[model samples]
Target: MVDWLTVLASGLLSFIVSIASFEVRLRREQSVEESAEVEDWYTETAAHAAEVRRTWQRLWDSPEHPGSNLTEISSQMGLFERQISRHASSGEQLDVDPDVVDALDALAEECRKPSEHSFHSNSNSEFVEFRNDILDAVERVEEHLAEN
Candidate 1:
């Protein structure tokens, strides 16, 4: 009778340990998959932001005809703004750093302002300062995004 009881006890202990091990592995895999998904999202957002930054100054010179240049950059910037808005909302669930969202909002605000002569021969130092601020904000988003 004692031998049968010991066998039953050992079987139960082994089953519990196996289940605990499986649970740990399952949780770890879910974490890894979530991280990969987030990284893909970050890659897309970063690429779009970089493209906007690169083309920002070109809007003034981008027109063959008149008035088209004004619309071109504004349209692109609008798209960029919408992307940031969506990303910020999605990131809220992941507990993304607030700094990332704050910087994104700042970028969206700056972009929404009419492309006020992104650059011109007579543009003052203020233009340079504004451009630098935009760059810094973009970098800040990229930096904070990787932390999550």
Candidate 2:
């Protein structure tokens, strides 16, 4: 009878051990799944950042066109602004730093202001210079976004 009791005890112990092992495996699998999810989020964020940089590059490349309609330019700028706002609102992390956003905002505000018409030859040159400056600011923001 004592031998039979000992055998029963051994079986019970083995059952407990098996249960614990199964639980450990389940926990490990859950952890791996969570890690994979985080990796996917990071990859998606990076892709969004790259897209923002590309848009900035396009804006900078063709800031001033002599023959371009003002309405078209204004529409494009508005679209870019909307895209930036949308991406920032999305779950993806911002590629550009907050400071860059502030700088760009200020530059954009300056560009939006109506220029005082002057007969002076330098007036057009001044406007061109201002546009160039805004483009430069956008480029800087783009570079910062791409680096991240």
Candidate 3:
């Protein structure tokens, strides 16, 4: 006589093992998907940062006097600040070198200070240097992403 109970129990055990194995595989795939999503976000954010830096550089290059429109300058600064804050809030480090941040902050402070004179040679030099620093940071971030 066939041992029906034993066969049924064995079948059940095999089915349970299969289900467990599938569950583990699903979890691993999900983890991989999540990781890819984060990486995509990082790359996109880096690109946006680079674009902003370029825009700032262009604005600085304009013949218009720097302090002529302090309001516009302030608006741009606010936008940059928001961008950095948003990335930080998203749990992604800005990936900008510390030196770059310091240079930018210094430039911002200098802009905020009242100047008796218009754009001096030193002022242009400082602005160019700060812009270059931001570009460098963007390049570093791009390289890091590429390597990963």
Q: Estimate each model's TM-score.
A: 0.67, 0.43, 0.58
What candidate 2 gets wrong by more than 4 Å, as runs, is 63-148
* Model 3 lDDT per residue over 1-148, tens place: 9899999999999999999999999999988877776666666556656665666655665677542433454456556655654554453333334443443344334333322223554665555554565566556555554554
Scored against the true structure, residue 83 in model 1 reaches a CA lDDT of: 75
Error of 2 at 132 (Å): 13
List, residue by residue over 1-148, the lDDT tens digit for candidate 2.
3798889999999999999999999999988876676455445444544443454345434568552333444445455455544544442343334654554454445334312223354544554564565466556655645554
Best by lDDT: 1
- RMSD in angstroms, candidate 3? 6.3
Candidate 3's displacement at residue 95, Å, is 14
Ordered from best to worst lDDT, the candidate numbers read 1, 3, 2
lDDT of 1 by residue, 117-142 (tens): 46455344444454566667777777
What's the lDDT for residue 12 in model 2?
A: 99
Name the weakest run of 10 consecutive residues (lDDT summed) in model 1: 60-69
Task: Please report the candidate that would top TM-score against the real structure.
Answer: 1
Q: Candidate 1 vs. truth: CA RMSD? A: 5.2
Considering only N, C-alpha and C atoms within 3 Å, which residue pairs clash in candidate 2? none
